[model samples]
Target: MFDSIQWLIGIIKSIRINDIIDILIVATIIYYLLKFIIGTRGWQILIGLFILLSIWLVAKILHLPTIEWIFDNLWSIGIFILIVVFQPEIRRGLAKLGERGLFRYSLISKKKAIDEIIRAATFLAERKIGALIVFERNIDLENYTEGCVKLNAEISLELLISIFIPQTPLHDGAVIIRDQEVVSARCFLPLTINPNIPKNIGTRHRAGIGISEETDAVALIVSEERGEISLAVDGKLFRDLDPLTLRKKLIEVLEIEKPDFIGKLKNKLFGKKKWKK
Candidate 1:
């Protein structure tokens, strides 16, 4: 044990600044890669791979040459298959890295995005146009973007309204907003499995609440039947909201400013009335 400790110390002593930086870069990449894998459809595939690895390790320890050989060959060919399967995720991650390095978001841009979304929501609600709008927060929604309309466009009232129009191709699914831009349109969301949800609550509202249940993202829904606006966060649905209340909820939930943050915190601490079911 003492010799092992000494050996580890010797290795640490030989580390240079560049070596530390290289390690940090690799660690960061791996961190993001794992994060991007979770909440994605490929998560189950990754778990299968891990199980296979465990089996291979056991085979090696047991001196089972045939099992080891099969696993080794499978891995040799399976690496390519993995790349093919995770191609969209890899491409999206690389693109995000490039964007993060190249672009920046100002508070003003976020404000504009909020204004546009509010205007669009109000328009849809008044017209009884069903809409599902999602605001991506700490959790990455890139997993849901695959096969959707990858707009990555500036959030505008006109564009948002157009996308949610009844006859439009992208009107059926949710629009995901990240930072000051719309990351995707027509992205399908998981439906809430909670039985407590009212039977009258349709798929749109269930999908909105479902996403909030899974991640920190906020969902806004426009009810076509009643022309009412609703907010879904943390698996709880807030119903019968006006344009002004919706804007306040967005500012508070997204934590765009200190004042809204304080208000959200206050509400949570005070145990205020929350709309649910």
Candidate 2:
């Protein structure tokens, strides 16, 4: 251990400023890469890989040649394994990186997005038009969005209402708004597999819960049958919320404000009402 420490100290002393800078750059890239994949399915896959590695190590220690050989072969094909297992995640990560600049610029214009969504939802609800709108958060939905009809238009109440008009081609599926733009319309989202979800919930609510379950996105649903507005976040549905309540909930969930007594009181009241129903 003493010799190892001496060698490490010598290596550190021998490193030049350029080498340190290069190391820092590489480390920063790795840090961000891990940050991007954290809490995702990719992280679960990584945990599985680690378990497999531990198993391989045990096999080697036990002199199990066949197991070691199989594990070694799998390790040799690591690149192919990554490609097959993480293609969608990789593409989504790249897309998110590309959009980072746009998102940063759009931060100044987020109020416009909030206003447009509120107006559109209010209009649709008043007209008894059912609409499913998803707002992207940290998790990228690029793969799902790719399967939809792309609409890179500025978000507006009129445009949103027009897209979800009955008999319209894009009226059947959910619309995705990202970076203050309508990224896609008619996007198919997953249906929730939660057995505990109430049987009274329809396909739209199920889809909203499903998408929110899989990603960190917020889903807004305006029900045509009941003309009630619902919000889904993290797979939980908050139904029959008014515009003010919905907006406040969204802002709170999205970390737009610090916690306050009034907000807490409102949430408590809302919780009780929901629980009673």
Candidate 3:
């Protein structure tokens, strides 16, 4: 017991600040990766992969030559296989990383953007015009904007409502907003493979949820069928939000103070708990 205690002390002493930081960074990455895959089909694939890796490890430890050879061959193609299998997740992670790290805007600008978005969504919802508007936060959405018509115009309630009007050329796809501007319209986003999404939800809703699932972007959907407004964030959908709640929620996301205040309180209470970005 004494020797074990000494060893523990030695191990604790050896852990430097840099080592702690390194461990924290790795832990954060793993945590986010798990969060990314959780509740999706990818989680099942991850479980299978983990089992295979464990079997390989056990076989190597037992000196099983045949099993070792098989696993070695499998590992040779593992990179390609993983890339193909996890393409969506990989794209999402990379998109998250490539964004300008600080997702901030002036208070006045943020309020204006939020008001414009609320106004547009209200207008679209009133007309029962299906609209999918993605508000890019920390995630740069340019990769998903390919083949979209580049507008790069200032946000306007008129333009937003007009874009989603039925029979319009750009009515089918999503509008991508970045830095308080509509950068593109008719942009295609990846469809989520999450099986839990309701079958009754149409492609527009799925795409909204999909883009939100894949990035830090906020997706606002105005359902043509129901004339209801919904918001998707981090793979979860909050359906049938009234204009007041929608405005408040958008402000909560765009404003730094509320998130920062909540984050600081969480850190003080829980210490390094996963705070929303």
Candidate 4:
């Protein structure tokens, strides 16, 4: 016990201020990275990896040569695993990082794109046209875009409206928007696997739930029947939001800016009452 106490004291003494700062910085980066990947399939794979790592450590300590050897081989093939398992996330992370340094160039481009999308959504809402718009942030949707017509065009309200017009070729499918560009139209997204979803929720809503469940993408669904706007994130849906509310919520979820308490207070006092109507 005395020896162990002395060893602990020695280790503690060796840890300098720089070490604490380094640890904090690393921890903060990891926290945000995990936050970005939360609710995605990558999270499950990460959990599995942690379990495997724990087992490997136990095996190493226990002198289990066979188990250690297997883990060593697996570590050697980790590059391939990353390529296959986290392809979408890897692409997105790279895209986000690229955008950071060239903010000025991308700002106007993104603003124009967002404006067109807002216009399109408003038009659909006014006409009671159902639409599903999935906006990519730091994640690629190429795999999800399979079987869909690739537009790869600059986003415009008119184009969005045209695609989702009833009985049109792309009317029944989801549209994927990335970097202020419409990458694809009429793409089929996965349906939610959750059994507890309400029976009344239709296919479009289910698809929104599923896609959000699997990725960090935000789903905007405009109901054709009720003309209600719903936002889905992390596999959960917030229904019956108005245009302004939707925009605010989207900005919040996207982490575009820090929340302003005064603005929030004002909104709570005024916006809620107005929305109640």
How does each model score on lDDT?
0.87, 0.85, 0.83, 0.82
Best first by lDDT, ranked: 1, 2, 3, 4
TM per candidate: 0.68, 0.68, 0.58, 0.62
Worst 10 residues of 2 by lDDT: 268-277
Model 1 TM-score is 0.68
Q: Where is model 3 more than 4 Å wrong at Cα?
A: 1-108, 256-263, 266-277
Residue 56 in candidate 2, Cα distance off native in Å:
1.9
Cα-based lDDT at residue 204, candidate 2: 92
Error of 2 at 127 (Å): 2.0
- Candidate 3: 10-residue stretch with minimal lDDT: 99-108
- Alpha-carbon runs more than 4 Å astray in model 1: 1-15, 94-111, 126-129, 136-150, 165-173, 178-180, 183-195, 199-203, 210-217, 224-227, 242-277
Q: What residue pairs are clashing in model 2?
A: none
Candidate closest to the true structure, highest lDDT: 1
- By lDDT, the better pick of 3 and 4 is 3
Q: Estimate the overall C-alpha local distance difference test score of candidate 2.
A: 0.85
Better of 1 and 3 by lDDT: 1
lDDT tens digits by residue: candidate 4, 60-104: 999999999999999999989978998887787778677564234
* Model 2: lDDT of residue 120: 85
Please write out the lDDT profile of model 3 over residues 118-217, one tens digit for every residue.
9989988888889999998766576788899999788889999889888889888999987678889999889878999999989988998899888888
Cα lDDT tens digits, model 2, 50-127, are 899999999999999999999989899899998989886799888867966423665436666776788888888888
Cα lDDT, model 4, residue 90? 77
